[model samples]
Target: MLPETVLRTDDVAPDIRFDVWREAMAATMSPMHISSPHSSDFWGHTRLLTLDDVLLWPVAMQASRYRRTAELVRKGDPELYHITLVLPGSGRLKVDHSGRRHLSTVNDLYILNSSQPCDVEVEENELAVAIGVEIPRNNFPPTAERAIGRMLGHRISGQDGFGAVLSPFLSHLVSRNSAHRPSDIPRLKRILLDLVTGLAARELDAEPSLCTETRRRNTFLLMRSYIQRNYHDPGLTPRTVAAAHFISPRQLHRLFEAEGITAAAYIRGRRLAEARRRLADPAQYTTSVQTIAQRCGYTSAAHFSRSFSAAYGMAPREYRELEHRQQLDTELRSLAPPATAGRDPIPA
Candidate 1:
């Protein structure tokens, strides 16, 4: 069945609302929230929340005096699974199982297994969005034991791993679902659940269980997408690219080999092509050839000019001038339209 609840604090006093949220959540799920100033209210700046389904909890919050304690577990049980992502701001988490207190800032991820308890605190005036996935106690995936009560908190930016793709994808879904149909929610739920399991397996360093190949393919597409987005970095070489994908140098090369190009060569070719196109543009007459070259990854002006001449059989300056004139003539021809027979031919 489709989820049937959208909860917010405006309906009640913030302190009372906090208690209501905790008890209401505990009835259908296993979780707890404790705050330092027990009398303080937290709703004045917080936003309304909608629960798509119990399989996932997506919440967006902006708080000024935001201080709270919370835990999530299986419905009607003390143990199960829960995961958290920090969409914004910075705070600290203390996981008893790990006996460590870690900081979570923008883009960091946090995971918790319900078999045990977790305690976390947020600073005042912090803003964040979080999604929690709840699963039955024994329903935890086979590799779940390894990550029991583990908190994976750090930026998994640029599609490096499951966290990278999952974070942005969930954020987009949660934001767009305001107008989404009920039928579409189930498919989205399955994807998020599968991703959570995959992430847990990864956190435990386990090889993918069944859908390994599919996951690998998705991850590759993700890495390629990141490359496209960062193509202008100039320093985006194999090493940097490998780091982004969280893979070994050999692995990075193999991914490219499968696509038929060496990493460095691909980057260089893209830079050169972008430079050539810019040089052929007419409206950019005032832009210097050296500037274009540097923008396209050439650091030395002399080397760039030499390479440009070799590639096009003329210096960039000469080529730009020729292209500029050609463009002007084309524009003039286009604007003047065709000459009619009644028009007299003029001397050249």
Candidate 2:
């Protein structure tokens, strides 16, 4: 299994929770100056994943200000590059890097290098959710260094271009971390490295400098992202995807072959996963099974039913009903004070 750690403020006393979080951050990254209106009861949640020399931290925290002054950098610099992707949240996050201040909103990403002073301000009363990755500066390709330095202060769109793929990549790597075995670590590292280097270089129109292998992996990721965005369209097959990317069908299959899967299988797998997601969501509960199937690219309800059963061990309708039952049970349990045995009672 991949090595990971969870840091939470829930169990810590409100008065000292921020202090604990600060000390933890100091040990985890470089020491920073942190201030927040909610400091007395500051709330933060972070899951740290150790990916060899790289560290991935998916965090949700209350609004706060963080600064790494030159004094702090002088005292100790970890020499790492920090990439932060704002997943979803209200208000804005302001990041000052390389002498420029940039405002970031949901689905935006920015970079900060440990060798320089930086400032970050998260708006008050807002809970910001983000996926952050830290990689030793040395880990990046030399060809990317110049571009990365120039791009550090600018905002990158998490919803477009390479950011679209890289954002989801980090999020999934963290969210599905448990599904990865130790044997998967090396391959994950290689992918992570490729995405980071490839994104930076491509952003500044320096794609030609990247090695052929990095370029190949990036093409595969881009094609995967395209498939995901258009999976709702019924005609999104591997052949069509290849044509869209200006590659032959055989070439598309070769890309997946390197990953030990086939292109057609990957497309079907994405569709099935999308169907399962909608099936379990309560908001989609009222939607008809056939409608959901069509929405997920199944033109025929019967075919969708059979596919859903084979993938998830239940028919589409059966799965939706089962989900509803489970959700109702959960709601009923939450409302039943008797069932809150392990939870703390409200303060009098």
Candidate 3:
């Protein structure tokens, strides 16, 4: 997974929480003029996930206002692009130089350019939550790059089109950060980049710049998605998939060649991975190996056992037993009390 940084105003004294939050924002993001209610206390929290060159920040806090003046832009600017997905608040953003303004509300999204002077005002009386994605201005393809200028200060609806897919994907990513492995970051980053680019292209109606290679890659992605959803179906095969996509079996093979694996092999690998996960799950302990094998597309228990051993260097039964033992050890450790010096020992 991506590396994460979490900041909370609760970590500091209530009186100085706003000051600490302002400093942290200036260091992590760009400098801005901030204003909040005249109350004696402040509360805010932010979680930032860094993936390669992209940054995702999810924030929640008391309603406040912020402004990035031309002076601040001139002093120091990263020249980044930001897409803000507003969750539960009302706000309006104005591009000072362009005289463009966008009124934002719950489930709305807006794009901003770091090189421009902007002012934002959030309604008070309730907490406001938003997730912002930052990327280098040049990260988009030429088609999307041309559209960015016109998109500034314009509200994009998160309820439909590309926004519909992007909104939930980002929310889920932030909510499930702890469940991801390090190796999954690169793949997730690529998917996010593609989705962002596609959204821009859709907005600009730039189908030509999407090009043949990009379309091919998208087709491959769709094929993989189909496999994932249909892996349990015994009728799935290379010919069937190619026919569904209106392509020849030979073309299907060529598509997978780019991934360094054959279609059949990829399918088998995904099935095996799912089977292993099910086998290791504690809730599936009473489930028979033969049933799991059938559920994973293996018609014969012996065949599944042989293939599982070849791939994982152990039989399914042995793997399940080992996972069970590990789970029990973890439970025992959690139940045991901590040892302390000069403290009476608890009776077992």
Candidate 4:
């Protein structure tokens, strides 16, 4: 599950709100000097989700100015880099290493190194909102340093190129309020890492340096994502997927082999999983089994029933009954009084 933290200026006393916010920012992120013209009436909020070694922060704040100085670099942790995506404001940023200044508008992204000195000023009239991803320096390829150095203080459009793919991903991750399953964290982390690596490699013209295995894994993930989005289309097949990705069917099968599953089997499994979920949902009870089957890409009810039974060891109707019974049992348990030690058990 993604661990989260939330901070707001309203939680502190009005007189010391800015100071509290500044201290919280330094502690949560890297040490930096933060100020605002309306410090006394400042309003800001930050929501952060931690996924393994990466930190996703979505922030909304009033006009503010911030700077990371050489002194702070010497005093703070200097092994992190921040990737920021502007959402609703315009700002000017300067990187000390390159001495270049850039104006960032909505959907523009830029990278900042914690070890380097930088200054950012957001206009007071427009609220500044952005999603910032904090990644460890070691998570990136060695060649990325040169690329990042060259790109620092420059605007990268999130509406085009690799940013088009990466921007929505980061945005979606931070937008979720529900906790993710613990088992899914590793896969999510790998996807994020690969996307960032690919972006950096593209910037450096160093795609060849990315290991072959990593590239294959990323391609497989891309295929899986495509399948998930388009699985309802009856035309989705291994051949179609391979063609979309510009790979041969044989090569696609080879990639799936590394995970000990065939491409066809994976697609079937995903469709079955979705069907099972719908069957177990109380709200979907009015929907017919045949309708559910077709909705999940099964051609006919008999085939769906056979596959469902083979995968779950129970027919769809039986599984739905079991799920309903389980839900009732949970509600009953919640309503019952707590058990007491040395006391007789409640009669059924």
TM-score of candidate 4 to 2 decimals = 0.72
Best by TM-score: 2
Report lDDT (Cα) of residue 235, candidate 4. 81
State model 2's lDDT: 0.87
| C-alpha lDDT of residue 136 in model 2 | 89
Cα-based lDDT for every prediction: 0.59, 0.87, 0.80, 0.80
Runs with alpha carbons beyond 4 Å of true place in candidate 2: 13-15, 246-250, 273-290, 300-348
- Cα lDDT tens digits for candidate 1, 232-283: 6767787888897688878878777776888776776677678789989765
lDDT of 3 by residue, 65-107 (tens): 7788899999989888778888755343333334677677788
> TM-scores of all models?
0.53, 0.80, 0.66, 0.72
- Displacement of residue 227 (Cα, Å) in model 1 is 4.9
Show pairs that collide, candidate 4: none
Candidate 3's TM-score reads 0.66
Model 1, position 169: C-alpha lDDT score: 64
lDDT of 4 by residue, 1-348 (tens): 478898898888899888888887776668998988989878889987888888898998888888888898998775787888887554443333347777788888888888788887887666788998888888776765655656766778876546666787888788764757767778788888887776666666666777886677666766776777677777889999999878999999998898899989989999999999999898998899899989999887999999999999999988988998998899999999988889787899
